[model samples]
Structures are given as C-alpha cells and as structure tokens.
Target: MKTMILTTALLALTAGSVSAQQVVRLATEGAYPPFNFINDAGQVDGFEIALFNELCTRAEVSCEWVTTDWDGMIPNLQSGNFDAIVAGMSITDERREVIDFTQNYYPPAFSAYAAMDPDADIEGGVVAAQTNTIQAAHVAETGATLLEYATPDEAVGAVRNGEADAVFSDSDYLKPVVDESGGAFVWLGEPVQLGDGIGMGLRKSDTELKATFDTAIQSMKDDGSLNALLTEWFGGDDAPQF
Candidate 1:
C-alpha cells in the first residue's frame, strides 16, 4: 500500500511539473502604442500586454513576451522562435496560408500622418499594410503609394522628418504617434476603414494553443475585463473591438 501511494504521488508531481513548465512564448512589435508600446522606462506596457497577462491567468499557463521588429514578426513566428504573436496583426486569408490567427481582437482604420501644414497633399490614398498585412489587397486595389518602413516608429518618422508625404496606419496607432511627435504631424481626418480588426497569430500546427487563447479572450470580453483594460490604457471603452 505504501509503495503504491508513493508511486501515485510521484506521478502526480511529474505531471504537475510538466504542466507548470508549459509556457506560451509570444512575439510582438513592442513599438505599437495603445496596443504593445514600450514605456518611457523601456518596459513592455500597453493594452496587448495587459490582455496577454489576463489570458495567461485565465489559461493557467506561463507566458513570455519578446520584442520583434514589425517586418520580421511573421518570419520569426513561422521559424518557431515564439509560439504565437499578438502585436496588432490583422486576420487575413493570405496570411492564413502560412499561419493561423485567433478571433479578431481590435478593429482597424487607416489614418494618414502628414506635416502639420494644412496645405500639404497628405493623402497617400489607400495603400498596403507593409507586405504581409491584410491591407495588401486594398493597396493593390487602390494603387496607393504603399509606403514601406521597417518599424511603425520609422514609418511615422518619415512624415515627421519630411521624408514621406504621409504615413498611413490604424487610427489608434496614429493618435499616439501624433502625441509623441509633439505637433510635428497631425491626423488627416477620421481614419478610413481597411479591414480593421486585430488578431493573434500562431503557427498552423499550434491549433490547440490558438483555441485556448480564443476561449480565454472571449471570456475576458464577456466579463468586462477586456474593456476595463482598454479603458485603463486608452482612456475610454470605445476602443475598436477585435
């Protein structure tokens, strides 16, 4: 009886260890504001980080966050450096060929950033969202300039430095940039809609993790935790839903 009991305890301990060891490593473009921006002290702090922490708690899994460049995000995710991505990536069929995504988490809109000069023809028209974003189709359809930059900050910088006529991005993203730019740039108008909604990116093979995150996200939304976090970070609950 004693031996059997010891064996069962050992098995339980081993199982617990294995379960505790399970960690979902995530990659993000730590520069996108109100979503995954880095703070003044250079720590990760934003809506996505808060949401990720909440999901980690609900899923009862350990999570590790890492910063990656915007352009390199997909390739790094596909290469298996991380288990998933939650850096404001949009859900699109073209990206589906290479990876899977969770349910939409945030809405998208295209906002143009140009010099504060009102006379500038800042409208670059509808262009693609880099090469990998869902906005590729819109860019192709509209034949917009499709300005490309390595990072969100750099793209926004182009306008600040007078390098580009305007930088097009989601409205929430543009607001923070405008704030940081200190009036060097201004929003052209209400951000135009462009398949706006954010989603988590995961490898197709990690379908189980995707499902887990999806359920946890839904629960967070239902419980108002998601909205609360949005309000905490974005100053209101009217943030675009995913």
Candidate 2:
C-alpha cells in the first residue's frame, strides 16, 4: 500500500506549475488489485486508475501514469520522479512529516490475518505483511514476529509456503484472495482498523495541486459517484461511502 515502481506512459505536458497545462506524472504500485494493478493488457488498471483519470479530468489537468517500488516511493516523489502518488498509501503522521496528503480517497481499512490453519496463534505467531504498511506497523508491536515483504502477494505467499503463521493485510485486498483460494485460506481473527485512510501523497510545496485534487475528491463525495465507484470495485458489502 505504501510503494511501487514501474514504467511511464507518455501522455501530454506543459510543466511550469502543477495545473491543467502540465502532464502531471502520477505514480502507483500497480500490484494491488482492485486498488491499482497491472492488468492482463499490461497497463495500469484498477479503481484508483479510474478515479485518477476522473480526478485529472475534473481538475482539467493532463496526467501520465508511472509505477515505482513501494519502499522507495516517497523518496522518489521528493526527487521529482512524479508529481503525486495515487497509490493506496495510508495517511499517517510519520508520512506527513515528509509529504502532505489530500483528504482520504478511501476510508479507514480493516486489517486482518489470513491463514490456512484456522487455529493459528496470531497473537504470538509468525506474521507477514507488506513492508511500510499500517498492517506491518501493527504487527511490529504485537506478540507476533513480523516478516516484511516488498509486495502484498509475497506476504500472502509466506502463509501458503509455511514461512509464516499468517498474512496480515487490508481485508479488501485479502477478500478476493480468500474467495479464490477454494477453501484453503480463511480469515484468522478479528479485523483491526488501521490508518486514517488512503490518500494521494504530494510534496508540501505542491499546495495548488493538492487543492485541485482535494476539490475533485470532495466533488465526487458530494455527488455519490465516489461511493458508486467504491462499491463497483470493492463490493457493496465492504465499500465505505462519504
């Protein structure tokens, strides 16, 4: 949820300040399905991708999509590799010290443990989580030993391979996995709510750009389009509305 890196697709540009004239280069992990991922067509496609396209349209700005490694994402942003990160990054005080965030695009998420064994001791068991996520942060303070992976798939794989007792992650990301697991994987314990929610990460100096996207986000919220998109991607059972 915190990072990713990939190639850039050329679109349009102007580039003096972050406005309609400039082709704003936006970054995403392109690995988290339903949120952001590389589709079979080998293009970035997901709920966030659709939302970004809409936000850019609303802000009247042209944008190009890019992907980058999760761990290096924030640093890459500061280095000007992209204009903003639309990846599913949680809004937290630690991140705020280095970058600013617009109002949340996704609501606070429930993090849960998934394991093949229903009786797995999540309290003191070996647990895997994507590095830099709020799920990983929660695990680090628990009786469970934390194993951080660079990607969400790897964290889930740890449980399948017996490298960890369970995988902890955003339930939205985990739900589809479990459903597709054919009775092999099951949710392990009570879902834990973590982070303030998902938001776009921007440089502090990009105040104008932040304002632009924020206005677009609120407009979607007010119009019910945001909720419709959320349900479409994540399902009505779990998708939270404004």
Q: Pick the candidate with the highest lDDT.
A: 2
Candidate 2 to truth, TM: 0.93
Q: How high is each candidate's TM-score?
A: 0.80, 0.93
lDDT of 2 by residue, 37-97 (tens): 9988788999999898888777777778888878878988999988898889999999999
* Best TM-score among the predictions, by candidate number: 2
Give me candidate 1's TM-score against the actual structure. 0.80
Q: Which ranges of candidate 1 are over 4 A from the true structure?
A: 1-20, 108-115, 122-131, 134-140, 179-184
Per-residue lDDT of candidate 1, residues 38-123 (tens digit): 77876777888888877777776777777777777778788877778878887766777888888776655454434455555544
Q: How high is the CA lDDT of each candidate model?
A: 0.65, 0.88
lDDT of 1: 0.65
True-vs-predicted CA distance for residue 180, candidate 1, Å? 5.8
Which residue pairs in model 2 clash with each other?
3-70, 4-68, 4-69, 4-70, 5-67, 5-68, 5-69, 6-67, 6-68
